[model samples]
Structure formats: structure tokens, C-alpha cells
Target: MQQKLIYILFIFASVISYGQVNLFMESDKAEYNGKDIVNLTIILELNGVDLEPQTRFQLPDLSKFTIIGSGSVTNTLIDPATNTLVTQKVSRIALEPKKKGKIKIGSVLVTVNNKIYKTEPFDVNIKDVVEKRSLATNISSEMYLNMEIEDREVYQDQPTVAVLRVYSKNMDNFRKVKDVRLPRQDNINVHPISFTKSEIDPSGAGNMASQIVAVFMVFPNEAGYVDVPSVSASVSSYSNKNKIVSNRVKLNVKKLPEGSPEYFKNAVGNFSVNVYNASKDKIEVEKPINVIIKVSGEGNLPDMYLPKIVSSPDYEVFSPKITSKVAPGTTGMKGEIFANYVVIPKKAGPISIQTEPFAFFDPASREYVDLGQKTLALNAFSHDQILESRTTVEKVNEYTNTLLETVNTPVLKTTTFKVKEKSKFHWNILLTNIAILIGLFIVYLLFKTWQKKRALVRETTSPKPLGSVAETEREIRETLKTDINDYFSYLENLKDNGDYEKFFDTLEEMDLEVRKQYLQSSSDDFRIRLESDKGSSVAEEYRNLSQRIQMEKYSPLKSAEGMEELLKAVVNLYSRISK
Candidate 1:
């Protein structure tokens, strides 16, 4: 009896381990900084049974953490002991905590073969970034970010250069740099300039140790004291890190003084002007004369204007054809402006074409200077005198009407012709009528056959009508309802197919369709209208939705929940507008 009981116990133990599944969960790190990323991996392993079609896996609640990235993979292996196939499914997620605290990850559930399995819950401690920094030696002093402006004082609409430099004492020890955020200000347009890695030098040769990381050409739209905010960059070393920041810079923009001459063309720099006539010194009346005026030097050529040439009673001056070639430079803008004038002389006399003086403010001298006046002299001849001198005389007619009345003439005889009588009706005419009737009958039969074929084709291939404009508008309105039932249907389908790009594209299309139905224009036009009407709240929401969609489509880190919330907000706004 004792031997039989021992044998039965061993058999029971073997049967229990034969067809079982295992679930395991682990984290890459037990503790993490609030800003650093942590990876969580959940794996499910099964033996002696394949995963069922109805099997499902669900991740734990991650509301307190930001999921930067997530993905899943499956693997199959053969067990040597039982020679049975084993399958493992792995799900990995990268996350960053929202705040410094003890975060709890709940149980992960897996359902397979009509059974449910779960992993135990765990806690992760997230320490504050400041605390992490205190534990290591601070090397922030060795690295710094500095911003310098070419000129602190600039005129409105003038281009100013802003250079951002990164300085480090030991380049060899620097590991990496990231999140170099630049400053942005209202009414200032920033243009980026390209640079390369070779431009950076750590050796103090001619003060070249600093790296010119970013160069921006900033243009101020309005005149006043403009304050440029500080910029920050994060740099990492072997055991320490630094958040380098530069000081703020203030710009003094002095408005152009009043009492500027009418000829002052809004030019604010050092420049020269010249005027000349391209026509002959003497010309006949009603002839056209050409005058060329050129303004060239360092200044705003695009905005500058040429002084109008006064039109007198003796001359008719048309509008000047203007052209310019301006380019940006380190010192300032440099180019030339050419104005071609066409003038007509109406009367014959000495004509004087005069131009008003051109003036511009010289920033270096801090004063306005006037370019001297220009005049062109020309002589004109009378049109009638020239025509009469070039005229040729014609000989007068010698014969009179009395001579023609004295002439005579003669007469002749006439002839007559007769017509033959008709014979009933010609056989050829009867035969022609019969042929025409037969041709008509044949054409009628062909027409009937073509009609039947066309009807059959139309029945088989014709497209359904899209209804009316009002019906389309109603459909669009229904689709963009605040409840977002239809929108979520599309979202779920796209997510299941792993097509986030198409998901964002569909949202954009919906936005456009909404704008077309209600505003009768495109999204761009709707934005303009909202801005013009001072609808700040609606405009802000629309802009935010557009920016978020664009960023999510291109960003490596994606958040499904964030996208859903944004879509809900967009749908709600559009629904309200549609109503």
C-alpha cells in the first residue's frame, strides 16, 4: 500500500506541470528620475497549447506616466524535455513619470485557451531631477550658452543678426547635447542659418573655442524697445549634466523722424541716387522720350521708391516701370533699384524734365541726407511744320464736263428663245425618292439598335448621384457631431491597422470638409476669417489641433489618449460652428 501511494503521487506531480502557461513582468530599472525614460516588459509563455484566436492581452493602467513608445513581438521555441513547441509573446513600453512619487503599475491580464492569467502589481520610485543632480558633482560651470546680437539698436523692418554660441572647457569629456530650445518673440521673424560640426573648436586658438551652433536673421516688424528672451540648452557629461542659459538682450528701435521729405522713399541706410535721359537731345512733337533713374547702395531696396518726375503741359509722363535686385549681407542689405520713365512731347519747344531730391536717413551719421536734384533738357519741333515740309504736290485735272457731254453712241437688234413642255414625271426622280425612303428606314433601324445598347450600358455602369448640396452639408454636419461616434469608428479602424499617419490625414480631411460645408472655403481661408473677426478662442483651438496633428504624425513618441482628446475637442468646436 505505501509503494502504490508513492507511485501515484509522482504521476500526479508530472501531470500537473505538463500543459501550463507562465506570465512574467519585469522593469529595466527599479528607480528612475522623473525626466528619464524607463522600460517595462511583460512576457507570456505557453506550452503544449497554441494561442487561441479569441486570446487577448491588456496592458496595465499608465495614467500617471507618459508612454513615449510601445511595441510587441512574438517568438516560438521547442522544449527539449517534452519535445513540445513553446510560444512567448513580449510587450515592451517606454515611459516617463509625470511627477516625482511612488508610481504603481497594476496587474497585466492575459486571456488564452479560455483561461485568464495575471502578473503581480509593482511600485516604481521616481525621484526629482533636482535630487538626482545633487547626488553627483555639478559640472554646469564648465559649459555655457551665450547669445550675442550684431546690433542692439535697429530700425524697424531692418534685418538684425543674432548668433547663439555654445562654449565648453573640455570637449573630450562631453558625451551628448539635446533639447536646444531657441527663443521666440512676437512681431519678430527668425530665419535659421546652416552650420557644420567642423566649425566647433575646443582649443583656445584666436578665441575659437566657442561653437556657433545657431545663427538667426531677426526682423522686427514694429518700432519700439524689443526684448529678446534667454535661450537654454541641455548638455550631458560622464557623471554630471548642465542646463546652460544665456542672458536676455534688449533692442532699441527708433522710429523714423517726422518732416521727412516727400522724396524720402522710406530708405534707411547709406545710399546714392542718379537720374539720366536715354532719349535724343532734340526730338519732334508727339514723340516719346525715355528717362532712366537708378538708386543703388546699401539700404532697403525693396521698400525704396524713386521720386516722381513732374509732368508739364508740354510733356505727358506715364508711370515708371520699376525693378530691383536686393540681397541680404552681414553689414546690411545691398542692391540697386532701376526706374524707367517714358515721356511724350505734346508741343514744340524747349522742355525741362525735373526730379525732386531723394532723401534717406543715415544710421551711422544719425541724420538725414538729401541727394541733389536732377534735370534733363531737350528741344522739340512742331508737327505741322515737319508734315508740310515733307508734303508733295499733285497735278490738277485738265478735262471739263462740257467736253464729255458732246460725245455720241450707237444701237443693235434683240433675239428670243422658247421652252419645251414637261413629260408627266421622270422615272429617275421617282427612283431617287424611293432610294431616299429606303436610306431613311435603314438609318431609323440603326438608331434604334444604338439606343438599346446605350441604355443597357448606362444601366450597368452609371454612377449613383451624390444628392444635392444641402444634403452633402447635412451629412458633413452629422459626421462631425460632438458625440464623435462616427469619428471614433474611423479612429479605431486606423489604430487596429497600425496606420497613425492615415488617421491624422483623415482628421485633416474632415476639418477641410467642415470648413467647406459651413464657411464655403478652405481651412486656410477659415483661419484668416477667424483672425480678421478677432475670434481668438476659436482660432486658438483650431491652430492647436492643426499643430498637434502635424507634430504627432512626425514625432517618434506618440500618445493615443492625447490624440483622442484633441480629436474630441476639434469635433466639438466644428459641431458648434455647423449648428
Candidate 2:
């Protein structure tokens, strides 16, 4: 009787389910660092002919997560594998873990009339936020550090980007990260660069809301497979400190192919070479004119430069005055570079501005790209005309100099001389004079001693102009309140402006002043307080920001960035420094 009743119940359940009913839970990422949003999608397929189009469902225990966003969509598609047109009602919920640990989303239940359907529980590993460097401690498995090179395979001297990022899943929010270390290899050159905090996943970690914390322009000096050591960093959060260590990365660098051009620059990147003049219509004779040679393109841009224009008797060419506006980007270092040559026509006639053909090894094409300006004649004065003007000037100068010499000639003369006789001195007068001399010297010495003592007193009593951390903080806050900080005010306009000297100089000064007043004195105090208040990232902000600032300020060729990234960082950090 029991078996018959169970069979009847199963038949009734299948009949009510219609074609084929199903419910499943899925996540976009297989592994998640605690900081990222764990996306959960609950999909329901209704395929039976007898079932209702829609039904109500209940979510499992999601009390441990903060739902930042949630939505549902309905769509019908033909399932090729199953060979059926199925209707799916998909519900997505973006969740941020409230706590760190190995956790799970419990089973979801759907009820219709008197029937109940359940979906299996989903397992989620939200890595623990350990507060120490020892990874052997009894804790859940964690993955936080990641490093990536834009191109794993490259030629010798070719440029690529390497990125290091630390994302802590154990913290409610990030406090700060610092001391990011990338192993140094003798065969590689690592140049640090600054970009805005971005969301592009250079490390292939995941497509979650994130920032590119550290970026480096990498160049390999040796040819062959090189093993790059793993990257590491110190990460701090509200309640925990994590030592993030990434997996090691490798780079394959190949030697340059044979048969390179004789004039080929030892650059391995794409580039375009152009040699042209400022004025197209006229080229004045025996005068200086600007001839432009612009070399601009992506690929090893930082190491690329224009070779000297070959010298010719027809014209004299000075070394190029290069102006670069290159900054790091998503791909690598990319921007326009200009080299201007001042050419003076020595012998005027039909002449051409001659320059050595610029060639660079184009890694993309696996060949050398060579280009020089087309042969264009300039209208100039002939050698005879140039010599005619010079001859006239010399003649005029010679005639004037001779006339002046003749007018100012010295007259011949002679004079006689006589010697003086010796005289005797008295002993009493000598003694009195000696006494006066001694008295005067003593007085002068006393005066000098007094002056030195007074100067020392003044220096010792003088007060420094440096402000305290509190004072500096208040001043920055006031500046922010008034919107008077010029660094942030006209940063956009200054980006395209040619001169960034003043900007970087002021930035260096600001960094120095802050260090002298705020960081050196009150760093630990404020760092502890801020971290206690869940704001350590602000403290760490200065660490990363100062580094980038120093790099930009001291780079061989600084970018006209106006340093918007730095300005935003400063503003963001200080704005939250209060309460």
C-alpha cells in the first residue's frame, strides 16, 4: 500500500511539472577575492505543456552578504544540445561578502500550490583576511596577488607592461597596500609608470570592480626564455594585514633576426618617421629655419628616438630639440614625440634638407621599417649672393677699424725718475705706536666675537615655517572646502599645455612638505587611527602616490600629464582623512 501511494505521488508531481522543470544556481567567477562582487544567478527552465508560465521562489540564506544590485530577465532560446526551445527566467544578484571565510549559499526552494521544489546549495570560498605574513597558519586557502605581462613573447629590447595588483577578499573594504615588490633580474629593465585607478583586468583575475595598483614598463636585455620571479605586496585592511604573494611569471625574448639595416636604431617597436619643414612655400637663404622631424607611434616608445640628421655642405643642421608628451596607457607607453632641427643654409641655391633615413625594427611585421622625408627643394640664395653680403660687411668693418686706429694713435714720449733717501726712527715713539696697535686689535676682536654670538642666538631662536600634521590637514581641508587648490583646479587644461615643469616642481615640493610635516612626524599615529576607523587606504594613498610623483618628476622625459591621477588621489585621500 505504501509503495503504491509513493508511485501515485510521483506521477502526480510529474504531471503538474509539465514538459520539464528545472532550477539551478550559477556564479560568474569560479574563485573570488573577498573584495569583489560575487554574482549569483538563479535560472529556471519551464518546458512542459501543462505548467504555469511564472511561479514564486524563495532565496536561500543570503544574510551574510550585502546585495548591491539585483534584477531578473526572461528569455526563450533554442537549446542546441538538448534540441528544445526552452523558456528561462534568470535572476541575478550582485553580492559583497559581509565576512571572510569559507561560506555557502544555502539551497533555494520554490513552492507552487501544495508542491515544493529545491535547488542544491552553492559553495563559495571567501578567503580569510589573515593579519600576518605566515601563510602556513590554519586558515582557508587564499588567492590575492596577481601579476601579468602584456606580451609574454617579445624580441630583445622590445617593451611590454607588467602589472602587480593586491586585492584582499577578507576585508570589508581596503585600508591600504604598500611595499609592492617585483623580483629584479639583471636581464630586464623595469620602469614604473602611473595610470588612473582602472577596472581593466590586466592580470586576468576577473571582471569585477577593481583597480590597477602597480604598473611597470618592462624591457628584456637578453634573448631566450627568462623566468621572472613572483610579485609580492603588503596589504592592509580595517582589521587585518595580508601578505599577498603572486605566482611567478615567465617571458620569452627572442634575438633580433639577421640582415638588419646599417642605420637601424636598436629599438624594437612600431614607429613612423617624418621629416618636413615648418613653412611649405619659402625657405630663406643664409638664415635659420625650422625643419621638423616627428617620430611618433606605439611600441617601445620610451626607448625610441630620432637619429641625427646627416650633415651636408648645402645646409648646416643642429642637433634635434626633442619634446615628448608620452604617458603610460592600457597597452604600454604611448604618445606623440617631436624632434625639431634648426637648419641654416650655408650656400644658398636649390637645396634639400637631408637627414639619415630613420629605421626601427617593427616587431609586428618582423622586418625593419625605413622612411625619410621626400626630396623637396628649398628656394635659397646662391653661394655668390651669400658671399657678396659677407664681403661687404667685412670691408665696412675693416675700413672703420683702420680709421679709428689712425685717429687714436699714441704720441712718443719719455720721462726721468729719482730715488729717495733713508730716515732714522726714535725708540719712545715706536713703543707708544705699538701700545696703540695692540689696544685697537683687542677692541676689533671683541666686536667680532659679539657679532658671532648675536647671530648664533638669532638662528637658535628662529621658528621653522613648517606646519604640523594637524595644521597641514586643516589647511588642505580648508583648501578643499574653498576649491582653491590649483593642482586640481586647472589640471585638465595643463595636460595639453607644453610646460609641466612648474607642476612637477610644485608636486615635489608638496610631497617634501607633507613628508616633513605630516608623514615623518604623525604617520604612525594617523595610520593607526585611520585604519581603526576603516580608512587605512588613505594612509597608503600617500605611499603609492608619492612613489608615482617621484617617478614622474625624475623621469628622463616627463609627461605633460598635469598629473590628474595624482590630484584625484590627493583629494580622495584627504577628503576622507577627517572624522
Q: Specify the highest-lDDT model's number.
A: 1
Query: CA lDDT, every prediction?
Result: 0.67, 0.63
**Model 2 lDDT per residue over 421-488, tens place:** 23754566556646655676678789889999999999889686778888877676555342325544
- Candidate 1 residue-wise lDDT, 1-579, digit = tens: 999999999888756565678997889988997556678998888775555424666778898865655668989888888777788888887675667878898898877777888899999998873221111125454556667785766776566788877666767533344444667877665544332222566664334366775565666656766767777666654455667677565565657767776766577778887778787545778888788877888755555566778768879999899987655555456678888999888888788888777788776676778876777777778866555555232111112234234434211111111112365555664566466556766787898899999999999996978999998778886765444356657866886676887888877766766566455476677877666654766775666567556545644445676566656766677655544
What's the CA error at residue 179 for candidate 1, in Å? 18
Return the TM-score for candidate 1, rounded to 2 decimals: 0.33
Candidate 1 C-alpha error for residue 501, in Å: 43
The top-ranked prediction according to TM-score is 2
